[model samples]
Target chain A: MRNLSSRLSRWLISGPPLLYLLIFFAAPTLIMVFAAFRIPGDYGGLLPLLQTDDAGKTEVLINAGNWHDFITFENFGRFFEDSIYAELFLKSFWYAGITTLICIVLAYPLAWLIARSNKKTRDLLVLLVILPFWSNFLIRVYAWMIILGPQSYFSVALNHLLALVGIEPVSLLFSQFAVIIGLVYVHLPFMVLPLYANLEKHDMALLDAAQDLGANAWQRFWRITWPLSLPGVWAGTALVFIPALGMFAIPDLLGGTNSIMIGNLIKQQFLDSRDWPFGSVLSIMLTLSVLLMAAIAGWAGRSKKERA
Target chain B: MALLEIRDVVKTFGDFTAVNHVSLSVEAGEFFTLLGPSGCGKTTLLRMLAGFEQPNAGQILLDGKDMSQVPPEKRPVHTVFQSYALFPHMTVAQNIAFPLQMAGVAKADIPARVDEVLEDVRLQQFAKRLPHELSGGQRQRVAIARALVNRPRLLLLDEPLSALDAKLREEMQLELINLQKEVGITFVYVTHDQGEALALSHRIAVMNKGEVAQLDAPETIYSYPKNRFVADFIGQCNLLDAKVAEVGGSRMKLEIPGVGLCEALPVEGAQVGQSGTLTLRPEKIRLAAAVTHDADEVHFKGKVHDCLYLGDVTIYIVELENGTLVETMLPNSAPGRARFFDDNDAVELAWRFDAGHFLLG
Candidate 1:
């Protein structure tokens, strides 16, 4: 009787989250995978799988006799047929890669400083890193818009400095640079949090040992700190890169027309062009690519462990 | 010239002084120890020697070179931390090779040297294993091997054996002695364990409140401590509160509170009718039910109050007539579980005339 109660409690605790994920996340993903193989409707969404004759009799139209009418592979074919889609995917990868690298470079020192600070100030610094979440994300992007605008003081100062060297005044707003800045700004906390957690658990004695064994400052960091903090780096990469790769809002606001990424194309396929099947195909490919990257990272980490 | 010398070094953290005007010199190829309790400035002294902490007003001359300007990286010294501090990500071999790689030793010689040190520590078969994969003793050996791989002029060990269990600690103590003899490097060790210091050091400096209370050979420090602190800190002792009644050369008569006048060795500049303490070891007392008389011995009478039965030795706490407790240790070598004395049994205690050392206020 006690075992039964314990088992019931276990299920009761886990049931809500399981049901929610199955209904919201897993069901939509399965439906999208099925949609990627279907034909586009005359107006929008997927084609109907049933039809009625003139005699008012209902019949199924998705069988082998008329399978081509409802079921199709052309949506998947179109993604491969057009090189433009492939180029857009490449552009998105490049943007996400740069954002992740820059985030690591910027967040590492901040995280280290927070980890090394005394207990009284450490909580305050971590709270400051997370304070951006309190305000609306869209509002933060708009704030960036003002900061990088053509008439803002920052851009004016940069242009003035460029004029002194006989260089052309450059536009900071609605450019690739603006897009990168927005992406990095939005995802920096994700990088900092995980890196801080990893750095905080590190033993300070290791650095002393390294130094006592004749390691200079740079060598100590490169040899000891960097290698030990790889797990955090990878975790931060996943948190930032996955979301940045599928981002459309930043590109829509700051990219103008020259920097439209794959995310922008996917949004346009479903909403503007009214092609849900093709959109599903692009979304599925993005998911697959992310899974492949995760697999490669896992394999690399495991192999290193085995070697050690 | 000494291999390592500190000329009046002082370290302070704001209002608190960690190491205060400490000066000492260590000879080359000697096993020296800084012994103290927690926060007694021994660690601070070791840090100064390792170049981790700079002295506010002093110079550290290592091998006749002023080490004030050199950083920890440039100093020819390495430390085995109490926690071992082995890099978790690196294998045993890689951990040992880190020093060689940082020193820019010839790339070709790095592997051989790492392997050699690993073999010396008897960890060759575990080279490919990570630090967490090994036991605590193995990890300690790895830390030692890593520090000794490049053979720095001096090796500093900051209470490296304090983390192990009692059995493992004794085993490692013997191993440390053997390893030091094999390496022949000048060692500067710091620990709060007085027994460990006594067992390993050729010379010991006992510190108290950021200053050295006594510095001498281990035998002298143990047998004739310069002050009450060193005598009390090193081993179990019976300190009798006494006053000097008369002084004659190195011998003096001390009138203890309950045991009457006793003979002991006087401190320098000993004056008659001054307050002092008579420190005597428990093992030095000749304890028995009734004893034969010696020519130059002080005899006393007491009743056994309590007894502790350890495997090799048993301690008998005897209460004198005036309510003073004195402990005397006897070996339990009679091949059975029988103890020497029972509680409330009257016993006799005696020691030689100059066996007790006296410290004056």
Candidate 2:
């Protein structure tokens, strides 16, 4: 009776979430992976794998004699056949990399300031960082769009200054610059929160020890503070890079013709072009790349721990 | 000439003065200690010596050079912080080699010096270990080695052993004494633990408030405290309120209100009819069931009020005929349970004529 009760209790603890993920998440992902290798029907979705004759006996439509009856690798081949898909992925990586760098550069000083503040002020600053999440993300992006548009006061003043400096006046909205600004603005809090958590735990006595041991201010920061904060840096990098790499909405709203990334193309293939098999193939590749990136980061972090 | 000197140093934060007009000099190769309770400005004064903070109204001279505008990094001094502040990211050897690297020592000479100091502290086998990998005592030794690797003229230690357990603290105290002797670097140590200060220091400056109450050798500070503050702070002492009835040379007669006349060694400027306290140590007084007292001893008739057995020694609280309680400690030299006195037992408490020192108000 005791053993049965213990087993029942364990099941009760893990039953709901396990069942929910299996039904909602795991099932859909497996279907998508299977669809990636199937042939597209005349309409949109995957072709039927089984067919029924007039006599009410079902027969498999899959045939090794016919290449494209039910299943094929044609969707994956189309992706590699067109160099446009590879270039789009490279562009997305570049945009995400730049956004991550800019977020770090802007977030570090803000995090340090917040971490060093007194208790009451530190709470208020951290609240301000998280307050952006309370509102609709689309509404925040739309607000940036208004600010970056040509007729807005900010863009007019910026272009006026550029004209005065002997440079040509330029449009700010619907450009790569606008897309980058939007990406960094949305992802900045991810970098600051982890960096702040790490910096807050540091002991000030270590800096005093460094200074007492004949290190200048710059040397103390470079040798002591910077090296100690690497774990936070890596965490912030992963948080910002993963989302920025997969983002589509910012580029859709703010990017020009040349700035469209792989996310935009994947959305077009699924909804506008009605190419479900091609879309599934693109999604699988995207998922694999994200997983590969996470694996590399985890490996790097573990190796660093072992050596350090 | 002294190796380091401070003249009228004062440090203030807003309206509160942390170190007020403190002045002292440390000799070369001397182990000097600043002993005080918390917030007595011992740490503040030590920070000034290390050039971490500048004095508000005085000059600090190190090696006869004025150090007013010098920053901490420029000063030829280092500190072993209380928390053992060894860099967590650096290994034991890297932590010790930090100062040498910062000082721009040649790359070839760095490894040899770091290894030597590691061997000196007997942590050669754990040179590749991180600070968190070591025990508390090992981390402490790493901190010391890191500070001493550069061989500065002065080393400041701020309660470096307070984080250890009692046994470990005692062991580290002895190690600290030996390290100081071997390095021959002038040490300016600060701690609030009086026993630690007494055991390690050549000279101790007992501080109260933001000022030095007394500066003397360990023996002198323990046996001949100059004031009620210094007397009470260093160890357990009984201060009996007394009035000087007769003053003569180095000896004076004091009238304890109900205990009648007793003689005590006088502080300077003792006069007749002056009121003061007689600071008497616990071990100086003798407690027994019966006593054949000498003429040079002041004797009292009392009842044993309570007793505490402390393995090595036991302290007895005796209530005199006048209702004043006095404590006396005796060695537990016997092999058995070492309980000498019990409650409500009639006893005699006696001390030599000069056992107590009188501090006038």
Candidate 3:
């Protein structure tokens, strides 16, 4: 009886935060899933409908058919049949992969240079890398749009230069390339920081020993330095890839209609089309894909640890 | 001709000089040691020899060729770092074969050379283990095997045994000596342990303040140290301040105030009426129960301040009339031989005239 009282007291002390999470976070998500399967009116409003059973009595319905039309898998089939949705999904994956690869290539040398530099220079470089992150991310992405858009300062200057060269002015705004550039700009620091943290902890004595053992510069890097920094590489790539996969703001602002990604499609279904069922299905798929990627990355990390 | 010659090497980092105009020559196939305290430039000099660091002004000649501009990868030298610095990503066999692979040796021949070196270091069973899986001594052997597989003209060791415990360090030292003899490669070892240097080195160069104070055989360095620093650094010695009262062809008379006069051998630059310090080894001084024969030459009366009974020897800290404390060692010949001395026991200290070395400025 005494232990039970103490346990009850402990739970009472910790109950407020748990209650807050349940009311604010968990209840809203469950309500969203509940709303996703409700019957739709002509204007796509969720309204309860009546059903007549064998007893000749009318009853208000909240069944599977009212939610998702008797679980026919129609939402998934519709997603696959639509070329636009399929293309957007593929484009999102491709863009994220490209961004990750580019980030890795550009960040490795910068991180290596920072790690090898003297103390004062290393501090300056780190400050420069982190200075952009201090500003609001939306403000930073918007700044890129202004710089790269036509009639902006850079585009106007380029137009003048092209005129002098007897060439026609080119459109540099609302392109897929613009969105990729913005993604890379925002995520480059994420990649460089982790790589720098790992590379800085490396023992320089190993490099000298390798050279003394007759390894040239390239051989030393390939055989010793690169393999040792794999953990950082994996982490930095994941940091850039996961968020870039779901990015909507940059693609919506910088990309034209033809370059829309899966995130923009999901946004359209929810707000523009007011179709909650299809939107939920798309959200679930995207979340599952991301979770799958995370699981794979985690497995790889564990295997590397075991090998080490 | 010398296998390696350092001609007036001077290295400075900004304003701090690490090696101050040092010069030495090492013959081929010799085990030479540079012994000193930390920050004494022993490792710096060794690094310069290996071409890791270039001297501000000097020439390093190896095998009749100048190696001042030669990169470390191109030089015919290797180093076993104190940390072992083994490649963490590679197995033992792969590490031993790395240099051979880098040199573009045939793939078949590389394995044979790797096996040969692995056998030499007695690490054949550990050929497939990574560096992290091996013990400290085994990692050290792998480092040696890796360096030896390249067949470098010289091998440099920078306090390689310092990371190990006492017993493992002793074992590694003997192994290193045996390996050097078998490989017939010149070894330039750097260590601060006087005992290790004396044991493993054919000749030792004792360094102090970025300069070589004395370089000679172990016996000569221990007995005939050129300066007070070398005398104090090598072993325990009782240094006494004395004035040269009289000088002769082979011997001199020194006046040690409060301890009476003493006859000592004159160093090379002794002069009359000059104040100098005399060095006497602890083992050379003997303790007598009473005044004995030949006591007038060199003897002093003192009281035992403290006594330490080590397993092999009993150490006596004797206090003289001048309040100077002297430490002397007595061998324990029999089981009860050390029981005679106690704290505050009256004792007589005596040594021969030749045992005292007068240090001249």
Q: Worst lDDT window (10 residues) for model 2 chain B?
A: B262-271
DockQ of each candidate, alpha-carbon based:
0.88, 0.87, 0.69
Residues B49-122 of candidate 1: C-alpha lDDT, one tens digit per residue: 88889999888999999999999999999999889999888899999999999988899998899889888899
Proportion of true contacts reproduced by candidate 3: 0.84
Cα TM-score per model: 0.96, 0.95, 0.88
True contacts kept of each: 0.97, 0.97, 0.84
Looking at model 3, residue A117 earns an lDDT score of 99
CA lDDT of B324 in candidate 2?
87
TM accuracy, model 1: 0.96
Interface Cα RMSD, each model: 0.6, 0.5, 0.7
Chain A vs. true chain A, TM-score per candidate?
Answer: 0.94, 0.90, 0.77
TM-score per model for chain B alone? 0.97, 0.98, 0.96
CAPRI class of candidate 1: high
Q: Write the per-residue lDDT of candidate 3 for residues B127-212, one digit (tens) a residue.
A: 88989999999999999889888888999999999999999999999999999999999999999999999999999999988999
DockQ of 1: 0.88
State which candidate, 1 or 3, has the greater lDDT: 1
Quality of candidate 3's docking, in CAPRI categories?
medium
Model 2 regions lying over 4 Å from their true place: A1-11, A51-60, A63-68, A301-308
